[model samples]
Target chain A: MSEYTPLSEVGEFGLIRLINEKIELRNSSTIKGIGDDAAVLEPGEKQIVVSSDMLLEGVHFDLTFCPLKHLGYKAVAVNVSDIAAMNAKPTQITVNIALGARYTVEAVEELYEGIRLACENYKVDLVGGDTTSSHGGLVLSVTAIGEVAKGESVLRSGAKVNDLICVTGDLGAAYMGLQILEREKQAFMANPDMQPELEGKQYIVGRQLRPEARMDVVYDLKERGIKPTAMIDISDGLASELFHICKQSGVGATVYKDNLPADEQMLQTALDFNIDPLTCIMNGGEDYELLFTVPLSDHEKLKNHPDISIIGVITEESEGINLATKHGNSYPLKAQGWSHF
Target chain B: MSEYTPLSEVGEFGLIRLINEKIELRNSSTIKGIGDDAAVLEPGEKQIVVSSDMLLEGVHFDLTFCPLKHLGYKAVAVNVSDIAAMNAKPTQITVNIALGARYTVEAVEELYEGIRLACENYKVDLVGGDTTSSHGGLVLSVTAIGEVAKGESVLRSGAKVNDLICVTGDLGAAYMGLQILEREKQAFMANPDMQPELEGKQYIVGRQLRPEARMDVVYDLKERGIKPTAMIDISDGLASELFHICKQSGVGATVYKDNLPADEQMLQTALDFNIDPLTCIMNGGEDYELLFTVPLSDHEKLKNHPDISIIGVITEESEGINLATKHGNSYPLKAQGWSHF
Candidate 1:
């Protein structure tokens, strides 16, 4: 058995040494890590992209339904998704975690294990971070760094009229997954002996707990020799992200109601939660899917891509953003994105 | 009377609009901010220095003793200190804050007011950040970006044997200030009607509540044509930082106890608190002063500098770190740095 030395015993330096003892730098750009005043990165000849996200314990995730390991993975993945939205490759990340006294060394190790796994999968290096104690719940803040050629990065403002709007993978699944987890939590709270009804909801649950950013879509676009005009991640639902692209790019869009992709399980889950399936597809957040705009001439190349859906096309700003319904009515789109404040 | 809207009522988009409504980008390097998937910076031909710090409410500051405005100012100041330690000039910062339900709009404005003041004082742009709700107390995470020309930035691993070690201004005053604040807090808690005994403790109190980062020292060093061989800020304590420099530079140090700098008020305050003055000067943290090493030839140049104290010289690695007492006994130095964990 290992000795149980309280953090108070060694103070901050001792704790820093204990935590940083196992960290080995792997990237050439990482000139420094935990020992210096700040981690140094040399992003030679490439424009670096920086994204930061903060996750709170009770607001972002419930400990009852989310494992610490998955929480750590999701934190890194969501930040990486922001970089992926720029069509850049994630290269390094700094993770700052605030843990309460309730957590043990073993628990922190489990969290870092998930972080390590995500880093390995994404080929990103864990460069540096600050770790401290929290007065209450856990807080994880991740800053991800990515790189693209000087003029090659896809920005939200780059979309133009006639660009083909595209979305990768199905939406509304992560929101549906959250609903299932909340229902199970409520059920378990009401009746402790009741078994969780989670047998068939594994896919949605996994999406909620450990959603992967579509780096694969980034690679595929490169392989097909097509550069998107603009891109963003659908973390705050399809409709909200579409509005962002339109507003920033000074363009308008009309998304076909039927082309808003959703898995069958997602639809059923939304129905069970008394939420409109269409509304869930439009406004459900945390999907971690990529939304991009490609030139109309490149449509043929991506038209048959299995995981991608050609949802709409951009229009002149005077036309206004709209949703073309199955019943042939066009309604102006409104963003109902996720807000933490 | 002002209106009060529940965050859930306004939802996320409305909150984003409320927070970002007044923010305007002042720097050309800020290619994108809140509207984009990720903030982009164009650090043209300059190496960028990035540092992150997380401040929890009770762990880092008590609401009773710290006004929200000072807390905000201190938060930005501390992050700027990290960049200053690298011999770089801060250009932009991103602040992420998570607040509990009890916070009001006015309170947030107060916090932002202090942040704005710091930005103006430091000439740093408030580029981008996330504002979110927390489950418990307040948390602020600030990431500072700074610029340094190639080969101009200093690191902690450049000190050589026989190099003279220099420290700016005084040490231990902040720690003493904290002690007085705590004592007053306890006294006020025990007797609600008691007036705080804060008349003569202004210097130490200010040191603790609003410690300024040694940006002036960095600028002075540049003006004097003196580049430190190695440098670090006295955030964790003098001894802790010295230990870091020695370990990284592969050299030891011998600091003269008589050369240790301590403010008169700090010495008196330590005596009043029944703590050793020399002990406080050596191990007390959060001074926000600069500790550096320079070639012995440069010592004469800085000998007349008012703010600098040449406390020691680098020693061979086999000698180990030592502190020579005024009475002639040498003791092996130890780091009892502040512990948040």
Candidate 2:
């Protein structure tokens, strides 16, 4: 067995001192990072955007299959996704984690390593956070701070009729990935000696375990001088996010089934699980892709973008949100996103 | 029983709508609140301060005696206290909560009601949050955003030799309050039908359950033209926080035992519990009062303040941090704050 140091051996203050030694502040706006009652930031002329999200063990992830590092990265990524949806650049984040008695100092370091990696990848500073003990399982909450130029920020209530609806990258791979992992876990549980089969499922599994926020798409749109009329990250599935956009904007949308983007591995895994691919694409959560609307005039700028899919068009509220099938039949879309409750 | 609607019946979206309808944004800096992917704020010409804190059920509070509303209020107050310690005014807050299946819609409403009241009292906008179901008891995380003039913010690393050590209100009351509550709980467990006696302990008990952030002191200091040389909120006891300021500032402090502020009820409770009052005053946690240092020149401005107490003085690092007793005996201070590891 490897060395295991109980958290009690190094008290909270000692643990904080240990963590503080390794943190490096990356943002110029951060006047003071850790070691203060609160982090001080000078956002300068930019408007600040704040987003918060929480993930709980057993409900959000199973520690048996999910590594602490990936879980930490995913927690930050989900909060960053929210900031990305606002057409902003993430600058700083504060993470609050509660660990149970079973966790060791090494375990916390592993978790924080992932958090640090994500912070580096996203170019955001780990400014401040709180760490405490929990009685049940690990609980993590991340709050991301971002900045957007005046009048450049996007909102979910800006979509208008005749706007083109777009989505970044692909969806449903994460959902299919979750299915494969669950299946493997079930197989492993049934027979202790059997090795779980996960061949040819790396893409789907990775998507489920380590999703990335579409900051690239946000930057690309800015470089192309295109501002989204409305935007939301696909955390609660495509259909659910579209509902939020439509309801907030007082408009309806029509998405063509053929235009829905799906990764090859995701489609294969969905078929292997005998589930409808469209269901996985439209109702699967945690994709962290941006679902947005751009003016029809900007379609020419985005039409040839390989990573983007123009899936729908905004319509009057009376039209209702609908999905057009390959068979030419239109049906109202139902948002069945993951509901923990 | 009153109407009990399970969370599943309303779904996540429905619950969000219910919560959104009741939130009232109070800050002019809040450009957009709730509903969007993130909340937007325009902190014109001011530096922003961010603070985050998390509270876990069974760990931070005992549900057996702690009401849901008080817990909710305490969560916000604690985070706000962190911001106040930086000499900033809290402008906005984002809350993330995970509740178990046992929680009902009414229960959630009660929790939010307390949150809403805190928001009103602090004049902070409840801008954004994430709500999800957990497998265990409730988990709450709150991030507070505040603003201060670019050069007006205080840090724990600015104390200089000969600075006056000041504290707001009284200390040890909240810890003593907890002792009384625990005693009552044990008594109640021994005899379930016995009515709990809490008549004479109102002041101390209120201090424990509904501790307020010392934002009033921050404003008062500003109005009186006094900028603290160093400041920190006493969430982890006087001795521990003093250690932080001294270590960060590279100075030592001499606190007089006779000057340590104590509430009458707290002193009485300590006697009743057969605990040393000085231990409660110096090592007790979660008082939520401001412990700070100011230049010796500003002592005259603060000397007559009713709620402020001049407890000690900053000294050269070689002097060491010590507590001077009334008997002319001085002993090195020991920090024994709460360790939730």
Candidate 3:
């Protein structure tokens, strides 16, 4: 074991200088990045969208299994997912992080390295933020700002009756990944010498540890000239998000159980854990995939998209949100979102 | 004793709904507020500025003496201070808060009430945020967004030689307030039944609990046709901030000790604590007051202002930053900023 330099050796100002020295601004709208009271931006004619998220250790993630780099990446991706859900292009982000005294300068650099990588991958500039010390576990708060054309941004209340509902990518993988991690932790705790079995669980575990925002889908949609009528990211399960769109839009939805997309690995893992695959699809959280609605006329344009699933259709409010089975039976949809409280 | 409802009773979504119901959007630029994936804004033809801050309970404040409402207001005020330092009008803010399981619904409501009051006072719209549960102390993260006309924004790197350095309001008050609170806390800890004996320290205590951002001075300076060559908020003491301005602008500063402003209460309290009054003024933190520089030609326009003090003059970079005594003596200014780590 090697001795590492503690955070106190760098101090707050030194830490900020270290972080700032490596940051490169990627957006033209960013007038000032760091080393200022606030970051300045010139958005010109584009409307701005702002989203914030806070991740706390022991609540949002367990550092025992989650790497700091992946945690940092996931934190930025979650906020970017919100901006992408608004049908916007992310431009800048401010990260406010609190670290315990036990953390080292090298640890802080590793976390920021992941954040910097995410910023580069997403084409967003790292702007201003606050750095402070905490007595408890690590806490990270991120605020992402994005831009969209005047009339192109989508809202949760824009869905109309007869609209076609769509979901990007497969779901339930991330939640199952969390279950696998928890089980492996338990097994390791029971026997310290045990080699945890994780060979075939790479994909599901990756989904849980590092989820990517569907910004690519937002760009692809813009290039294809298809704007979503209503959009939201799947952070609190698909059923819960559907409820949000329906409630805000004063409409209802009918999603087919068979149409719900799931990764094959996630389905197999759910069965291995004696959990229903449909339950994982409907109520599992933190997918970071886009769930949206579009006009029925856009069906021909989106039907054959490789990664998109035509999951459902919007209906009148009186009809109620329902899930249709392959056996021609229907049941009112129920949502059990992950409630931190 | 009354029965307090647990935070778990409302859940995260219910808590969000409760908060959203009380919020009223105050800015026209806010196209959409709460109940969305991301808040939308239209800052047409204007440049935007963003600043973020995270305050941890044990690190930043002691909940035993500090009220929840004041904590929330101070959180907003500090972030807004960063925006003020950029010479911009605050338009919106997004708050991300993590509450411990011990916190009740009423406690959360009290916190947001303070945030709501600050938003109303600052004329900023409460746009969006994330609320989650924490295992440790309470955490409040605020991100303030403001706008300025193109080329009107001030940065810390603009000061040049011969520019007159100005600071708004008195300093050392907030730091002294913290001292008084700590003394009173210690007294209470020694004897549980003893009164606080805070009869004469109201002003200083208030300064610590609720420091206001000097947006009024920004408006006043603009009205009087004085644009600060450089600006920054005094969060980590005046001397430390002066170093930032000098380092960024490639200039030195010579501040007169006699010109350092301090409230009479703070001066008296410094003597009461057997501490040097000069130390309290130069090295005290959390003033949230603007320290700015203006050209020599603008002196006549700002010299008569009641709250503004002409503390120093920018000099050539080789001169070094110094403090001049009233007795014709000069000393190199040393700054011991608050280092949490």
Candidate 4:
């Protein structure tokens, strides 16, 4: 029989020691990782980029369907996605977690295992963090640090008129995956003996559970010597992010409805749910795809890229943001992003 | 009647705009504040020190007695105290907040008002952050950035045998204050009629509600040309932090029981609660005072200082950590730190 060890047995310092002993720092920029009041970093010529995000249990995730390991991975991935949206290379991260009394030492270890795996996959170092108790649910907040050459970073404000709009991969799969999960959860609640019908929806389910940040697109653009005029990750939805770029860059855009990329599985799932595929592609959130703009002169280099689609071109500020239908009709775009309040 | 605006009415981007409009970056190092994928900073010459802390609403604070403004101020101060423990000058901070749906825009502004006040007082910049909704309670995670010259930072591993152990200000006041608050809360719950019997407990109550980090001691030590060998903020009780220094530095310490700092109000409150004052000084937490060790040669510089008290001396590892009682008995000291888990 296993003996129970209350967290009070080891106290705060012992818990910190247990966790810190397993952390291995890989970045040279991280002069100090843990076991100190603060972590220290070496100065460099490149400009540093910092982004943070907080995920709450039951709000950002449901423990019933979201495993602790996947939650940890998603927390780090989302913060890293913010850094990647600036077209920079992530170097270090700090993760702060607050857990209720229900968590065990082994459970926290599993969460850290996922965090460590993400750090290894992204080549980012885990520098420092705080672990404390929560009143009720779990809270995970991650801060990502990255670097870009003095003027090489692509901000949301740099797009110019006639710039070609580009996006990586497809959209709406993650949103559809969430719909499937919620439906399955309701079915299980209604009938305890019912099995989850997740057989043919693996693609969408995986997309929702473990969305990957488009770091590959960032690297590809760098290798091709093409700097995006403006860039942002599709997190709150394609429509909202596009509006951010347009408002910040003081320009407007006209996107072709036919050019919007949507996976076949996502379209089928949207049809099954009685939702328009175009609406899903435009307003569904958490795609984690890279949406960027490149000058007209650099169009040829990206025209044949398999994973990228040139969907529109930047227009004058007065033109307003619009989506042109396949029927040759145009409608002004309105941002319908996710709200967590 | 108050109008209700569902967060969905404005969406995520609109909420971001609402918050960003109130932020004004004041530090020159804050090259970029918000609006981009990440905030950018330019720290010159000095080594950057990063410290983080998370405050959960029912764990770290009771909103019933703690004002939101004070909670915000306390969050920033706690993180700043960590930087001060490293003998660094705090320069900037990023605050991430997750609030429930019951919060209003005005309430958030009040919290920021307190944050801005603390930042202005400390000459620190509010650089960046993330704001989102929480499912249960409020959570605030702050990362403070500071700078110190190379080789000037004092880590817990730098303490040496025969060094003078020193503490700044009185301990146990915050803990005693907490006891008073808890008692009052119980009374309120039982009757819900009698007014809170708070009188002449202002000092301790304030200490618990809005404790200030001793950054002044850091500046004064530099001015006096006195560098501590090792240091840590007394946020986790004196005995517990001393254990950290001893374990990390591979040494032992002997503190005099009579030398423990205790405020008059704290002693009275402890007695009123039927608890020993010395025990409160030993194991009660959240004082935000400075506990440090200095070479014997430098003791004279601080000996005459009113706030600095030399409580003990470092010893060899074989001596173990001990406390010499006023009754002429020596006993091994055990850390009874706060355990959130």
Q: For candidate 3, report its TM-score.
A: 0.99
What's the distance in Å from true for residue A243, model 1? 2.0
Candidate 4 chain B minimal-lDDT segment of 10 residues: B4-13
DockQ per candidate = 0.62, 0.91, 0.91, 0.69
All candidates in order of DockQ, best leading: 3, 2, 4, 1
In model 3, state the lDDT of residue B23.
94
lDDT of each: 0.86, 0.93, 0.93, 0.87
lDDT of 2 at B131: 92
Q: Encode model 4's per-residue lDDT on B278-318: one tens digit a residue.
A: 88898888999999999999977888798888999999989
| RMSD per model, one decimal | 2.3, 1.1, 1.0, 2.0
Clashing pairs in model 2, backbone N/Cα/C closer than 3 A:
none
Ranking by lDDT: 3, 2, 4, 1
**Could you estimate the TM-score for every candidate?**
0.94, 0.99, 0.99, 0.96
Better lDDT candidate (3, 4):
3
For model 1, what is the error of residue B90's alpha carbon versus the real structure, in angstroms, after optimal superposition? 2.0
- Residue A127 Cα positional deviation in candidate 3, in Å, after optimal superposition: 0.6
Compare candidates 2 and 4 on DockQ and give the better one: 2
Superposing every Cα of model 3 onto the true structure, what RMSD results?
Answer: 1.0
